[model samples]
Target: MPGPVSNDQFFARVGELLEENKKAGHGSVFFTQKRLTPSNVQNAEDKDPLWDVNLPGPFAVLIRATNGKSKENRDDKIKVSTVVQPESSEEFFKQYADVCKAGMQALKPKDRSKRKKKKAKKRKGPVDGEKKP
Candidate 1:
């Protein structure tokens, strides 16, 4: 008899695939667990490995470009799409690395100073409120 596949194994497989697509020059990639459908929930007792816990059926991954562009401008920009599928650990990792690389490229850090300025402004008392003596 075959041993049951562990949850870690399943998650790792998905992560690996996303990473590969990122490295291949895609903008970004992410993995999410498949949700139970209304039909599945209605019929559920114990979790169904085929339909509930595993990767589920087909899904799409959207990778935005690194350059920040308005929605209209971005429409013309190239984006990457990944299709999820059953894959061995090794193959999955390859794909995951690619996706991760693209994600890294697309990520942009927020301006910390802008946030600090907003917080400081909020902390100020109203005009003619109280004065430090």
Candidate 2:
């Protein structure tokens, strides 16, 4: 997919999230310009050369769940990505909004304990394993 043309358009989508009703869940909608390399430049530049070359803009949306169903489980999140194109921007947004709303319902609170890394147990005596009382 392509991406939203202007910040206004992009923000318009973001604004929808403020209502706690976008990004396919209780999270945020992120816009990331598509990756560009020397080879891909040719096609991307076709639309706007200077823009594609210098600006290198956002062409996709990242929908991630933030804090839903519980406050402590903020880490539990659902991520959904979509592309934006001139032809499908509106449709994509509509689909994303619906997705956010639908997915949010089934979102399970993250288990904070699982996310925590287990610290290694300290050596009882010494690193060389020397016997000591």
Candidate 3:
């Protein structure tokens, strides 16, 4: 049997890959891990459960690419997101790699960072240099 993959190892691998892609001008990428709670089972006697069940944390990697005349421009932008669920460490790593590859291919730089900016609030009066009315 193969040894289990540690959380640290898994997260490290994800971080390394994400950084590599980001530095290659592949836009922006983020990685996050989430803990999943397993469903509780009830007995026929209607008594309290004997044991507590919970699932290990699942890691997620997101890659985003954008393109346009400039960062502020939103004329074009495309995105691709994927989730991988593996029962074991080996499976998880394999799935993660696959998802990352797929995500990279799906990236459309033209529309990656184009987002509408929020309107700025106007100040009632100038605090510095100018006198307040």
Candidate 4:
């Protein structure tokens, strides 16, 4: 989770994911947008992704959780994206790490100085050779 990410996008992805999972039976997820949309964005699904991992060309890495419904074993998953899914898990992790790192670098500290730029300065004595107020 990055600081300044879109709340709408986050919720949208989660909603689409749950919808896909619902459609795929027990615990599965499916793509909801075109295999390839310009800008890699779409109405609901493509705008955000669960795990980009490695999406070379018209591809994305979606996951399907298929574990015995229990509290302690929910991380189990199946790679669902196929168009350009990573060939190896190593690649998946690598891409995730990359996205996280980029997000971290993109964050910036908020500066209040910019918003409070109009500080009143004292008025100078009436002007050239004029009497003081």
Candidate 5:
């Protein structure tokens, strides 16, 4: 028996699965969390999914877990966003990647020199001692 799958392996497998499903014309498939809602809390069988995915629709399906549980698992950070739900996994990933890219950009240091140059250009009014009417 194998030990445990690393995060790299899990993410790689997820990519492969998405590609396979797309190539097979099964529409988009996404791996996302299914948070327990108040209505589902009382259902004994409606326990939070360890792993869940939706294919081409809002209906979610569970993926069997191999690692059982981990001490490093981030359950709290897995809250599903109720804001917008993409129709397909491809759409979901596209939106997710775009947000991640934007976040990365935000973390980058800004160039004050560039901003100053832009401001200088904007400050140029009428040029060569010409007055604005």
Candidate 6:
């Protein structure tokens, strides 16, 4: 079995995945965390280069560039991951909330598109009680 990957290597893969998303015309990506398990063993050199090494932490985060609902999309999905180890459960939750908030803010459009122009209403004449010039 391969050893766990270094933190630097994991983060580097993250950058590469982000770039891949941009090149593939993906506008957004999803970040998710998963607990490492025997069923999901990914530390094989044959499966994924970045995942060749076993991760240290119990939880691993995977950032997916494409939604995997469709078969083709699933095949084309690009994800990078890293292990996370916090000092305490409370710390983990706090940091998770902060990260989610930041991600939400980043996903929001910087400048909302202007509202569609309203059609001008046709005017037949002056007010019913007012005299026309």
TM-scores, each model vs. reference = 0.27, 0.26, 0.24, 0.20, 0.24, 0.34
User: Model 1 Cα RMSD, Å?
Assistant: 13.0
C-alpha RMSD values across all candidates: 13.0, 14.1, 14.5, 16.9, 15.8, 11.8
lDDT of 2 by residue, 1-133 (tens): 3432453444444444444543444444343444324445456555676655464554444333222334565454322233355455677667656644554454566667643433222444364366543
lDDT of 5 by residue, 1-133 (tens): 3433433444444445444544555433334445333344244435656323431245432222222223675341221122223344455456546543443332457669988988887778536346643
**Residue 55 miss distance in model 5 (angstroms):** 34
Query: How far does residue 63 in candidate 3 sit from its true spot (Å)?
Result: 16
Best candidate (score: lDDT): 6
Q: What do the candidate models score in CA lDDT, each in turn?
A: 0.45, 0.45, 0.44, 0.40, 0.42, 0.48
Model 2 reaches what TM-score against the true structure? 0.26
Could you tell me how far off, in angstroms, the CA of residue 111 lies in candidate 6 after the best superposition? 7.1
Give per-residue CA lDDT, model 4, range 1-133, as digits (tens). 2232232343344454555555555563332323433464434546566544444454443332222334555454322222224344456456534533443332466777755553322234235336643
Residue 35 Cα positional deviation in candidate 1, in Å, after optimal superposition: 5.2
* Clash count, predicted structure 4: 0
Residue pairs in collision within model 3: 65-112, 66-109, 66-112, 67-109, 67-110, 67-111, 67-112, 76-111, 77-111
- Which residue runs of candidate 6 sit more than 4 Å off their true CA positions? 1-5, 34-70, 87-133
Ranking by lDDT: 6, 2, 1, 3, 5, 4
Model 2 worst lDDT run, 10 consecutive residues: 61-70
Clashes of 3: 9
Candidate 5: C-alpha RMSD to true structure equals 15.8
The alpha-carbon deviation from the true structure for residue 31 of candidate 6, after best TM-score superposition, in angstroms, is: 0.9
Q: Compared with the true structure, what per-residue lDDT tens digits does model 3 show for residues 1-133?
A: 2232444454455555555555666555555444333334333344435333332345333222222224664443322223333445466666667656654654565653334222121242334326634
User: Could you give the candidate ranking by TM-score, starting with the highest?
Assistant: 6, 1, 2, 3, 5, 4
In model 1, the worst 10-residue window by lDDT is: 60-69
Question: Model 2 off-target regions past 4 Å?
Answer: 1-38, 42-82, 106-133
